[model samples]
Target: MKKKLRIGILFGGRSGEHEVSLLSAASILKAIDKKKYDVVPIGITREGRWVTADDAHALLTGSQPPENPRLAGDPEATPTAAVIKRGEAIIVPPVPAESLQPLELHAAAELSPARPALALDVVFPVLHGTFGEDGTIQGLFELADIAYVGSGVLGSAAGMDKAAMKKLFAAEGLPQTPYLAVLRSVWRGNPKAATKKIETALRYPLFVKPANLGSSVGISKVHDRSELAAAMDLAASFDRKLVIEQGVGGPGAKPRELEVAVLGNDSPEASVVGEIVPGSEFYDYEAKYLSDASVPIIPAKLTAAESKQIRQMAIEAFKACDCSGLARVDFLMEPAKGKTKPRIYLNEINTLPGFTSISMYPKLWQATGLPYKQLIDRLIQLAVERHREKHQTRFTRV
Candidate 1:
């Protein structure tokens, strides 16, 4: 009989997107196929504490883990740690430090029964930003040599930073709106000079964003000089690096928001295009999650040629960012106006996009004939395949 694969669904991170990640993870826990896999629910608190089993359940349900000794005495109920080394997720006693003082403790601890590892076959990190979505956690996965879902370290880092992603897109000759990257220190050192430099380079109606954030958090649209300072300040609070982009269109026309989902390891396939009609002036954090007014048009009304071009561009952008497993590529398009063929610009690529029902990434694939559950299955398969291929590489001279 085939053994049920042990799958770990990691959620609730230290980022501002923690709540959103919890929602995404909850959906997976309810919908994932239990017959084929043993699901492990791992939750990280906003304070960065990792919890599992009953503790994880408490975190998910808004209940605090029992601190009273009477309520927390079960040894098995204790929070278990997940470690990836020797190519599998395990829960072993942490190796002691190499220093002499710690070495004595290590020697003494070796006499005790080693804690059995959790043995996760694959980990699906539903975490959204900062330590989770950025390359930090991905690097830990690489060191553990375990198979996990989504892009590797390089891709995750690049995808998290808008400035870095745009540079890669530009190298590939993809069309994009003009923008400037600002460092918090530089802006603070000389606000007047920074304002002058921005005024000289771009026009009004610019977007200020924290380069390494997702879910439209710490983002603002500024119309004139007075608003730029506050917008920049807001963005700087989230990240040291800031990205200022020139608005896509002029006047009453808002640039059409289009998204395409790409799936696979190398030779990925692109899903049908989907359009987002934001409820607010722009798709702010409130409009993306808090409100239900936003509308999504599947297989967005586009000409056959435009659809083909967008699908192709989506794959190109995914590769340019070195993404694997899955990604959602966003594009800004100007509708065809007298003599002007619709101009499409590669906006950005989201390596670990939202998985909620209303999220565009999964929705785009569902529209392309791949159901939600099937999409999850395919992604797990891709992670296994990629890990197997990576193992083939000879790390040491053999």
Candidate 2:
């Protein structure tokens, strides 16, 4: 019999999307093919602890329903102090001394017992936001010389920052909404100056968002000048930079939101377009994960030409950002009025989009003839393939 490949399903990260990551991991754990792979579930707590066994089990079981797998540990267990060394995650006890100086010992230093390693062949980082989605962890993976799912450092960082992402799209000649990027320090240093700049550059009814966050955590829709200060404050609290975008619609017409999923390393393919009808005034975090009012229309009602244009644009944006594995390219479609045709503005690319049951990334692929389980398998394969290809480059000249 062929030996099973040891696959690590890493989840529960130090980000606002911790719960969402847990949910995504749980979905994968339930669906992942057990016969072909030896699975190890690695959990990272909000305190930034890398844990396995009981601690990881507790967190996963506690967050999941009774029907899911439960562990033999306290539901509210304290996290352990662990670190990754030599490609293995080890639980290191607290250092005894408070001094920052290096210890001087004449070959008399005590050594701790060796901790067993997970010996993972590949890692599937189901983490989102900050340390997870912003390319930080991907950088670690590259340094550790391990294969992991999703984009590399460059693509992840570019995809995470809205300002940088828009610049890349513009360079590729992709159509997008006009916006202004603001610094939190600049806004706080001179509120008058920042407000005047924003007002002068863009119109009212703007979307204020934290440049480095997602899931609409620090997002506000300001209708007028009176609401701009509050929105800026809210966004500044979340990130060092804030992005204020011009709203897509006019008067009473609502901007229809559309999304297309892209998958692959070099020659990526785009999924059939999907439309989102938000339940709230905008598609905030609550409407995305909590409420049932929001509806998703698969193969969104579009003319053949419109569908072809958006799908092709989605692929262009994905490559422009240097994304791999998978991404969900979002757009804002202005409703056609009079002789004016519908205008599609490339919103942004999510290098690591949601994978929950109700998430659009997986659903788009399911509609495109790739089921959830097969999609997960394909992602893992892509990671290994990308890693192998990357090894071909020589670090030093002979």
For residues 141-208, write the lDDT of model 1, one tens digit per residue: 77667789999999899999999999999999999988999999989999999999887888878889
Query: Where does model 2 exceed 4 Å of error?
Result: 63-89, 92-116
Query: How does residue 5 of candidate 1 score in lDDT?
Result: 79
Clash totals for all candidate models:
4, 0
lDDT of all the models against the reference? 0.81, 0.81
How far off is residue 197 in model 1, in Å?
Answer: 1.1
- What would you estimate as the lDDT of candidate 2? 0.81
Worst ten in a row by lDDT for model 2: 73-82
lDDT of 2 at 353: 87
Top TM-score prediction, candidate number: 1
